[model samples]
Target: MDVDYVEYEDYTPDNESDNNITTELPFGSSQPSLSHVLVAINILISVIGLGGNSLVIWICLWKMKRTVITTWYLSVAVSDFLFCAFLPLEVFYMMTSHWPFGLVLCKVTSSALFLNMYSYVFLLVLISVDRCVMISFPVWSHNHRTVGKALGVVVLVWVLSALLTLPSLIFRQTTVRGSVTQCYTSYMGPSKHKAVVLTRFICGFLIPFLVIVFCSSVLCVKLRRLTIKSTKPYKVMAALILSFFICWVPYHSFVLSESDLKNHSVEVLETGLKVGTTLAAANSFISPVLYVFIGNDFKKILKRSLTSRIEEAMAEDFRTVGLNHSKSKSMEIVKS
Candidate 1:
């Protein structure tokens, strides 16, 4: 029941044997170099993404009046912003190229990533369900979808996501392979590592992914069957769902099925994982563009912002011209 990558490709383990292995990624030869590159991108994404998602949260909570629709979007904005904020610590590991942060942070940071990613997924599912409910029972939904209840749901989602991600916290370890250090979950023993990884893949990506797809499909069908043409909100919702599918499906796909379970050759899997990781960050940007930027109020604010800048520039230009004219007249008098 050896759980080595070479063994995972061909051997089948008994139930007891499956749980015997570890997930702590062994450090690699190029650990420091890889960490530097990953750290740079992680920090860059966190800074830019944190600012953008903050604007989203600001617009939803303070600028735009909150309705049930806006409430759901605001919830999603907060989730994305939270992910962006804590993401810098992930780069901390990358900066050191080793998880010098120790067992506690290794567990916390990776667990937080899983929590945020799943929290976002479940929120999207909630939004789809809320839309369906509104369409089917607008009056009832209006009576019940209060801000307090929305807050409660968000709290529950985070709690549940954190619980699901707790194992990473519990088992997260910094491992060394030769000189390279990597932050990842470690199994208790070698015999069960592959099994643990496979299970994690299913739980982390597959089940919730299937749920999202099913719920979204049902939602689209319900909307399409309506007796009237879809309105602006529905169109926007559709666009948001489409963006979610495009941006995230490949990421999960790349994660769950990227490599053979027992193959020690993580080179291919790691390469694919990096691509998915980058794509996942991109999703933090797309949702706001699809949902917020297209709003009438958003457009008006953008236009006003642009206008203000233009006005300031014109005033500065006038002042410059006046100064030049005055200086020229003085020179002419002096010459005469």
Candidate 2:
């Protein structure tokens, strides 16, 4: 999402004046009904995301053993949980179109949004690559993959994501426009704005998406070659990757298109962006739901506790992969 601002024409600060700056809102305030609808949807997303991600965090941290898979799941859950935690501020801003939170909270909230964006996608990429490596070189992966190394990688992802989010912190500011106060990004010029948008589209969406697709493709080919009969693990992974692509592509597309102001109507673009962002936000909770449904049998999930079902799903996927690898290895030994 772009900086948190209200719907209004762009303004530029005077060279000699310190107070004026250009701004735009995440959603338009022209339609009070739309704002209300957005507020309702965002509140719902926040509630579901908070509950779902919290459950995943608790299950991953306490119920499951500390393994690479669990580490990735825990890290992703934490990222989503933090994002959902900060959503109320956005909900407030959207409902009132007034930012009384001051500049620091403004920056923090915006930064958290992107932090969740980058960290979540990067973690997904890591998971996909890890799965591929596990399939391709089971012995090496078994020996080299460790919870400690996974933690290091997760920390690195967070650090890189934070670095990418600095622009949001640097540009976000709170300013009073008459009776209303707005928090928005003041990029000062089109060049700077274009650069930020392009960076987000490329790093936050394009590259990570390509990598995930490649890894998924490779995994599919490898699994077919191995003649693996159980498709549950693949199904779960496919649902995750597909859901991410569905949720994020619209947001990125609308944002990237907004960069070219002449080609698109401002109102249309803004509306599209709001809708896209809602879809993107939906991704945070969707992962946990996917874990429940795609990861396990529905009947069994109904009988088991939520945590037990999730744990079983995680362990079941890992066990399936190991079993497939063992079978392949045994076949090779027999041939030898």
Candidate 3:
């Protein structure tokens, strides 16, 4: 899977003759109503994601002091914002089933999706590890953690994500079949397809998921040892992890199923994929919402202006995990 608007109707070598036959609409044209609904949802996601992530980026860049946490949030916001920014192109293609944009844009837009996927997951992993290190080894974190180092990590993430996304840029092409111009990935063979899908699953989801889980477990154990009363941090961390898992697992699962197409129906897989992709797209916007609601006090969230709430959320003391009274006081002094 390319994760584009098109329904991936794979054909074996036996029927490769019919590969270019663009009979169905990009997303199940059999039912016009369902396609319209998906289009509407995608449009909504694009609007909210772009607006919310832009606000986060602005705050991180201008309204707050640059800390390691701010650097991480800013990088994640930029990645999500870029993904949302290109969603209109996808929406346009979905509605008209046309690829008027040249080949360069076709490659760029398709690759942007995977770039966001890889960068977002990699940043989450960094955040998890940073938090774990902070709690588990506060003195070292206080001594060594810096915004410059975080920026270096962010650059590494972008480089790695772009390298992983090269397949989309190379394999994606626009083709004219009859009257419709379709933008799709052309894998060389089943082995190549399997390799891409497996790489995406392992790198994009599985390994990062394991790392996050381990970090979360460590944080939970360390937090239990502390006397902190606030559950806000707990809620925020859980929401981030759960939302990423819920929104992405379906997409990855359906993509993985593409390898064993003999056991599944094409129509069902197509529908599942469309739904999964939408859910995954939704994760881009959900992070900003989480920052606003879960990162702040419920009463204050309602009373505060949006900008103030977001600023406060980003600048919140959620990062501090007090180990003991004396050490906590000393850490606060060191932070100051």
Candidate 4:
């Protein structure tokens, strides 16, 4: 869609603050209930995620640097955590019913939001390939997939992901076309209306999502074909793919539903949209928790960190969020 250039945060571009900040986009209005719910959920997730992702970084980078995979996952955790840092602003927006962080913050926050989203998704794809390669071509991968090399690939991904999300930042500007302030993506001057429509969907959501889906599918297939000898690897990969689909299917579906402009049945769209968006955001916080906590003995250690009650073992995961579990994990990897 041709994103309407509307100012959302009560800041006009001409007030000298907007100098060059863009914080507007197409056809989005405030939904108080949805925003409130999203903000609360986002804040809760962000607050906890900061700790979890930080733990992941500490473990993978400083405690367990023996494998190349650790480096890749550590980067994913950091990126996802950084994304979580901006969740509070989104929470504020939800609570206030509008963007209150001004134009520059809107741009910076939204840019980080998208960069983190796409960066992690793409990183997951890379992880899939790395796993597939390790299975299908172990010697080649071992000889080539050192931490340094993996770090380089991850760096490239960050650069590429950031570049791809640049347009989202570029097109966002808060401009007061009328009395109401709005945060929206503003397409400059006259341009092909249909082009922006297709571009927005195809480029913004569809292509990136499809990229993850396609790569994940192929990687899964490759893993399956290579691992019929044992079902465990296949099961793990299948779980990963299932997780990705569960988290992302609704997200892409919402984009598809919103594909058509002038489909002013926005209330329906917003209702449907918020559900999927929150679900996807929930996945952001849930991924590391499920992957790392379940994949390891963190729960047991955390339970020891707590009072060591039988009830506590059953409720072990709660301690990762500072619920007072006793068994703690320590990684002694790199300091710098």
Q: How high is each candidate's TM-score?
A: 0.70, 0.84, 0.83, 0.70
Off by over 4 Å in 4: 1-34, 98-100, 176-181, 189-240, 297-336
Q: Could you tell me the lDDT of residue 24 within candidate 4? A: 30
Q: Estimate every model's Cα lDDT from 0 to 1.
A: 0.59, 0.77, 0.77, 0.58
User: How do the residues 121-209 of candidate 4 rate in per-residue lDDT, one tens digit apiece?
Assistant: 66766776777677668799878888778888899989987776776677665645355444565434223223433554465456656
Sort every candidate by TM-score, greatest first: 2, 3, 1, 4
Best by TM-score: 2
Q: Please report the TM-score between candidate 3 and the true structure.
A: 0.83
Looking at candidate 3, the ten consecutive residues that score lowest on lDDT are: 6-15
Candidate 3, superposed: residue stretches over 4 Å from native: 1-25, 229-231, 297-336
TM-score for model 1?
Answer: 0.70
RMSD of 1: 9.1
Please give, for residues 40-86, the per-residue lDDT of candidate 3 as tens digits: 99899899999989877776675566889778878988999999998
Error of 3 at 65 (Å): 1.9
